[model samples]
Target: ELGLPLEVAVLGVLESGYDARAMSHKGAGGVWQIMPGTAGHYKLRITDKLDERKDLVKSTRAALLFLRELSKQFNGDWDLVLAAYNGGPNYLRKMLDQHKKKTFWEVSQVPGFKSETLEFVPRFHALLHIMKNPGEYLFKIPEMEQAEVFDVVRFSENISFDLLSKYAGIPLEMMEELNPHLKENEALAQVNFYLPKKFGNLVLKKIRKYYAKLRLEKYRKKTLRVVRYRVRKNDTLLGISKKFNVPRGRIKRYNRLRSAHYLRIGQILKIPIYRSVKSRGRVAKKYRRALSRKGAYRVKTGDTLSRIALRHGTTVARLKKVNRLKSSFVKAGVLLTIPSTAKFQPYRVARGDTLTGLARMFGVSVRAIMRANKLRSRHELAAGKTLLIPDQGS
Candidate 1:
């Protein structure tokens, strides 16, 4: 873990360009993801290559041998070695890694790296770490979408990767990726490459096209939003609410959280603040609506100006006016006037309704409702108290 070792330390920055096998939007081979035929021809036997993929020496030697072949086949130039290594060297039909068709290095230093290859460069070090010490690499690995297709079988050495993929009815591309160490795509020769069948093959087709296009999309990013924060140890819902000046309830609810209990170490919790649906709909949808007098709130104890403001979608100055007060102070029992957290109809709390319960029904959180009405408990949720329940994601 201290220093990426070659067999277990060096990232395939030199071999597979340091990419992970499953997750990266970059659909290229990973640190040890040698192509099936190449792996077999190189004699990198797969006899359960699972943990072996992490074996530093084994993968390193295999990668080195593969690179050597690519070097010789690709005119002794490093570019073809890289291109062949990045995509498939032979896929070009004897074309070298340096084939003028846009090598991996050229794309990186020049074409900005293919979208799938986009993650390759930066992941070199990460691959190195995982290989060196898998335990420490848990968090380092990207949150993969779970290929759900990590198994294999043994067979003869005649079935082509393409042909086996055809028989397995799996995506030829994914079938190849899954059995990287398979030689000549013939997997176990006549036995063929084993796969997860329909779903497995389906995922292969989907990911190949999906992830291949996913490369470098960040470059085309559309929005600069108040990125959501994941909760880590020692972080309180209250503490986060204060820092962002958002009411605690809003923070909890915006994240669609069930209870503070679900708040785990490293849990990704959205900030109380949100951008409008203009954002691919991944986050809560926010829309602008006309204003009304009905939506309002007041200040209370444990009430910081920020939380109150966030709860009602109003600022401190406006909050001051709605109540016709100054200094932003209201006694523990005193209520301060404020607006809705987003555009929406306002209502008073009714009996049989807990803040958490109401928030859940309305897609708002107990914290959001509590903050809107300035309730200290955030969970107590009282009756007959008017509170603004903004439209969900607003």
Candidate 2:
């Protein structure tokens, strides 16, 4: 609804190279290079667990909202608005007051305004010019891929990505890649995260099942009480263990801490305290059973062995050995045994399709597609070829 030009979106490309994770030394971040204060004012959450300034869509909306306010403040003087965006509003106001100029062109004569701010308006204009006359300037921008569709999953409290990946039939890495706004390796329960639209419902469905089982298990182990602890300065797992009177190894395993030194200040860690007798073998046995539920997944178009392996938390080599596959390739409609539980579907290749493109479309690796199709590098694939798609495999 803002009156800002639609082309203003391109400004993100110049500011942060269109990288949501881009951060400057002065604390500007995201595609729009929004400062911390501006991010807060625009309601982009920044916390130890999540920094929404690193979120592509949210940050862009925040930037546009900020620009709209600036436009109104500057009385529709886009030059001054752009200048204030580069410098701060205070800087432009000081320049205006010192020079007694009512407009940006007059304020440009002031001494305090930085040289970069002076040229920023012209730079934006030049960008617009170039975009409008790309062929005239002999610029041939390559085609860009369409944006990925997403479905949002909201959490009320913190959840472990490790557990979610295992039971939710999603790859941990894929979840991380889609949700780059996360400050740590895990997702904060306070915010909603996005997954591929195709897999969102599946993941949510699996999460409910996994958590239901977990709640039942917790009820059975009535002696266990879950405690949330925030790490303080110079806190170590060993020190925390001593303070809590729990084994350091148990803490590590419970928290999925890969290393003893992987502690962060202000990061929350879950500590399970036992009120009654200590239970040992049963816990480990239950965990093994939960992780080892095996099933079969049929191959589908664009289905890759590696992707299947990842979804099931197995290695590609393990999957091949289990299926007794001599070659990397498998035809669509063929059923493959999953190391873990999963489902399967089928797809047909269309014209102008590349293996790499297909991999990206389904969020798998190109090499995986190659192996599933028994194709080598530079192998030719025919259009209209049907393929089997595995659900939640690698």
Candidate 3:
């Protein structure tokens, strides 16, 4: 453990009111208000599926290590360390050199010093004082309940958090709250899942039962076929899933893919092909009707023509042609026409489009919709915004 000052723990209260999910407009996140660059420098994982900055245990360790390094740079002067942490260390060092000051108070008087950084140090000290002597400030800190002990269960294969919650007899929301690093409902293989110590053995026993059920199902289902397929150039998991009429999760599970984004060309994969008893005539009719329909898609933040096309199972050329778009650029809130399909449809957020209603209509979970659009909360759903309704199989 780093030999940090006891008062350093109070920094979380000042940074984010001890909220692990807190995010600042400046891109700092989590209780420690760590920026993306700082998290990367400390080797904290930040990926599309996982952000360790929101993990209390990992982020706390990274923050302390960072603070310890800053302490060394400032020669154990916590005041300067705090200043450098708020304002870039390089900026603080430059200010110190220019002003020939050894302390934060002196350098803070310099003209170029930011007001935010200037107040940051004093704000921390004030909070530390108030925390140490709460009675003097007429603040009655409530006693906290005993902390719940957690047990980590590592999985060799990808599993749904929904399934875990059901098996462990824990609420889905509680499971997500306990495991903030998982961006989606499905926990990736090899990742350690933290569960209450009481439910650890129960979860393991249920997982074994689940596997037994899977084996039995496989044996009983005569229509199930295992086909060997080689990964091709420009092949994506989504593309492969679409081609085989399989869910992305199933494809990942069968192949034991750790990261869905990484698929090597020439790699062999075992694809489970479930033969349908229904004739091809019915499917053909459905496909023709789907192609005849036109749908509207509302552009959201970080939308690109290519990405939008991919999500909707179309091409950039087709999207541009349909929308009559002169350029590849698509701005947020812009409505574009798309060819309607059963798998992926676009729906505008109506005045009364509650998160629950939309999820119910799409036959998906609220969390699934939120995860798809990178929405932190249900409140992010606003009227007139376009939302991508994912396929139920997805």
In order of listing, the candidates' clash counts read: 42, 18, 0
lDDT of each: 0.51, 0.74, 0.78
Which of the two, 1 or 2, has more lDDT? 2
lDDT of 2 at 184: 78
How many backbone collisions does model 3 have? 0
Question: Which model scores highest in lDDT?
Answer: 3
Model 2, residue 245: C-alpha shift (Å): 36
Can you tell me which runs of candidate 3 are displaced by over 4 Å? 143-148, 219-394
Cα shift from native, residue 327, model 1 (Å): 99
Candidate 2 C-alpha lDDT tens digits along 239-287? 8776656679877867768999987553556666564423465553432
- Which residue window of length 10 is worst by lDDT in model 2? 284-293
- Model 1 agreement with the true structure over 3-23: per-residue lDDT tens digits: 212342343454545543422
